[model samples]
Target chain A: MVDSGRAPRRGRPPVSDEQRGRQRLDISRHAVRLFAEQGVAATSGEQIARAAGVSERTLWRCFPTKESCVEPLLTKMLDAFRTVLHAWPPGVGLIEHLRTAYQPVLDSSSGEDVEAVLAVVRMTHDEPALRAAYLVLRERAEETFTEVLAERMGMPPATFEVRVQAATMNAVLKVAADEFARETVGRGITPEVLKDHREQLAHALGLVTRRLSGTDVG
Target chain B: MVDSGRAPRRGRPPVSDEQRGRQRLDISRHAVRLFAEQGVAATSGEQIARAAGVSERTLWRCFPTKESCVEPLLTKMLDAFRTVLHAWPPGVGLIEHLRTAYQPVLDSSSGEDVEAVLAVVRMTHDEPALRAAYLVLRERAEETFTEVLAERMGMPPATFEVRVQAATMNAVLKVAADEFARETVGRGITPEVLKDHREQLAHALGLVTRRLSGTDVG
Candidate 1:
């Protein structure tokens, strides 16, 4: 809604925050594709810039390091997560909220965006630098989970119990993300079968965290 | 004991496993310090090689990426955990084994080594590149935990229950490491009291994973 095609009346033909974010995401998407096609070490900032149709200096402006070219794409994977957490209703349970949010997030996301995200995450397993970028994002996501869980559980984020919950919850989500990524990383699963994997994730989360309820039979 | 000093008269210089492990640890220790002192972005392979007193080519031989230069030092932090797991006798609980293993691990680790590890981990909070490396190490640690938990729980490593245990257990450890690293990263903690932090880790592990017992009041 914020995109204005016209040249702005403001000084320096200003770039909006939304525009800047999109630009960076575009550049990162290109970088990830290049890194995946060849290899991260073999791919240079100049090549990424050329593929993205931007100046190398502009690429550096958006990303300080070459290894960080995947950060924006990694952040994309977590966009649904953060949004879901932020909008989580106070009365609803965590599992219920996750199940509710899953399909909508998938529906809203373009196939290409999800494809790029999974591609980048898959590369993290093989590429140390990209993996590092991916992990940094994971750590940030855990921090967000801690805050959200703390608020929901009526405890400080730093409380020992809360942190464990946050960590374990994130771990379950990670396992799901891993499964989804694995499907794409290999021969690529069809959307219909992929939906079954989503259900698998929901089931896994319930099983893993059911100990919290004391309801699951060992 | 296997660190023999005798030079090999064969095709390549014979380095004992212990000796090679130590050599890699030494190089990685130096690299982490360099990363800590200067940002990872600013640090160069040549600078790290000079600091470690190795040729640039030798540094490349030891580590494929500049980001991976810290891997050996990280592996050192987990060495105690792995060794303790390997020696975990049957009929012993997981918590009990950890408590028994904690002190000896700390005692065997050199002050300099621990300092380097904490330094890098702390940097992870602020440095994206280093954070990635730390996360990569954390992932491998999870795999190892999965194997150990599989044996202890009498299940396959890939079992859902086994993985949840592995992930949760690693999360607890990460909290302890985070606390310990926090102390070292800032004002540094006393070694005697630092010993207490190890116990805190043991206690936290018990509390976090106790739910696995099917007995939580919550």
Candidate 2:
């Protein structure tokens, strides 16, 4: 039987997943700026579309609601961490991998992305929908951590130890990143400071992993 | 100079703090019942007063808004873990402390309080105000963890290691508790099974502490 799920051949080829994702993120960036400038309720779909240089129909096609506009940007921030973890080399200590591979993203010229992240954090403080979105992202990150952890330790993801370790690690990273974001906004702390935070996070994760696995990975 | 903040009394008041707290809790219990039955927006300060058998003015004096009526119940549930941690003995391991102290408060002979706690959880899913209040409680709980961890490790609360470790532990406890709540609602998991999640939590915390301190408590 033909797989109906597959994209149908048409005059214009379907947008690649990567292109669709970029368009979604483009809309999110515009939506965030609008949401930040005006309140979420005051912002209109047309305004976001205008800002993103896309048609209103295109914006709606990408996001069901204006509140959901934050998802792509938020998801990208989380995916950055997940990408690092996925690329982590086996037998290399967690701390070393984080310090060496993770620091460049924050320090690169793409500092505007860091500012976008801060806007989401500020929005979460007052916007319930955005806060819920942020929490959902966090839950997904925890699952990713659980999978990576289970693979590293040769255990099933459902194992109690793996779940607990994943939860602990998730909590640490979240709290640390939150504090870092706050500092970045309130005290003008640079992303470089986050390097030290990453090291501490790695140490915290290492401790939990060692205890759960009954072997030290550090 | 007389200290303005100091208590001005020849002797202590007739009602103890515990008695006052119980009285407030009673009012909160009735208010939550009305809120759950009639909905928060439909319920009013005057109606809550009548249900709790108190004056409307008294209800206002206690809580600023109708939504906050659930705070007392929500705070009590969140405080349960911290109260246990505060009473933890030095010789006991973290896991043992949790298992021994955590009883199924819902299964106790007092079934009314169980209903109140469940109502708060159910409301949290829909009520934005309640969700914000719930998050504030979580933040307080994390602070409590930080204090306990700092004391245990003989480090100042401002210490980087202490903060990171506390964050990880807080995350683990939150995820485990969240899972327990979800499971209890969806799968009819008993309190006994929920309590079993604590062992994994303790193991997670144990690993975090060992990694940070370079020594095992158990």
Candidate 3:
């Protein structure tokens, strides 16, 4: 068995990565619904666990704090942005590239997922815990932004200017997203409203990064 | 007594605003010191209370979370910036105004106060709890920034563009401050180093706000 290509598993087999991801998403969906229906302060871990059909122990293992239950959803949004940025072609304008590539992804994303994400974002306005979770995830994405921006600008990722640009870019995007989500939460997020948000984000990002060499073609 | 200049006093005499401010500052100093000596995770509320010569109840009343002990200092910094912005004259460049008016405030501030503030800012890098406190304070200050920028730009404060600029400005300042604090924490803060920080901040702010009519004269 030691010489075989596949090594013998120890004890019980661990949960597969896809299963873990699905579980997290399920819990995040339940947590977001609870948070939206009842305020984050009124929602508890047990309630969330019950709603998600998971035990308290499993919930705690998956997320350390009740506030952090939204991480998987937030991370998914950030990951999409990062993926789009990584695919951004050199010599193409950032806004144009995002409109071309990122817009389709947003259009294709399930309405339920988008609504959950918007609800979480909308809740961040009043809930400090949720806001912190959101900010921390956004902060983590800044490094990825810095690297991509640095490559495009021919500067080190750690350079003050490059880092500042990356941070400003993220801040503009975040503020725009927050504003859109806040305004669109009460009324349903129509395709028109979503398009408006995308335009607003692109416009803000373009204005902030206009001075950078590889960012603005306009 | 109601007709008289002095109204009838209720129950026990309340603590004076000055006294409350002093008490908060003292507790904050102690908390910052302990957090610096030992990591934030290792420091307890009781230890902070003891170090500050206050009861745990009082400490809790002053700061709900142990991480929020730094709010007093952070608010002081933001208040200074807000004051400077309010005093800023139209037609004057932002960076030049800061250099002329703000530099003196920094110069006159006690070294100990500066060190404590820097220590708190530096700690925000690795400590998620502390980082949350710091970010929340910074987020609050965005309103002041928005108001100032809006007045100068002749736009409504709540306008999306104005708000985005305000958020971006705060993000740039925060990133710069964190960087400066991280770099200067080990070596004692020097006047030269302080000036360098001011310049870096002004420069970064200028770069981000260059396109705005009221912010950049250059």
By lDDT, the best candidate is: 3
lDDT of 1 at B133: 70
**Which prediction has more favorable TM-score, 1 or 2?**
1
- For candidate 1, lDDT tens digit of each residue in B32-119? 8888788888899999999888899988987877878888877877776777767777766556766666663364488777777778
Task: Quote the TM-score that chain A achieves in each candidate.
Answer: 0.81, 0.81, 0.86
Instruction: Report the lDDT tens digits of candidate 2 across residue range B1-218.
Output: 97865866666657888876776788889888887888776888899899888899988887766766777776677676777777777756666677667554542326567556766776666765565455555655678878987887778996766777777777666656655555566555465665666665565566555643323442
lDDT of each: 0.74, 0.71, 0.82
TM-score for candidate 2, please give it: 0.70
Q: What's the candidate order when arranged by decreasing TM-score?
A: 3, 1, 2
Please give the DockQ score of every candidate, comma-separated.
0.42, 0.34, 0.65
In model 2, what is chain B's TM-score? 0.76
List fnat, each candidate: 0.39, 0.53, 0.58
lDDT of 2 at B125: 62
Candidate 2, residues A1-218, lDDT tens digits: the string is 98885866668777799999888988888899889888787899999999999899988888866777988877767777788888888777676677677753453326676687777887787876566556655766778989988888788997767777777777767766766666677655455667666776666666555643223442
Pick the TM-score winner: 3
Clashes of 3: 0
- Runs in model 2 deviating more than 4 A are A5-16, A35-50, A53-68, A104-109, A122-132, A182-194, A211-218, B1-72, B90-92, B104-109, B115-137, B154-158, B182-191, B194-200, B211-218
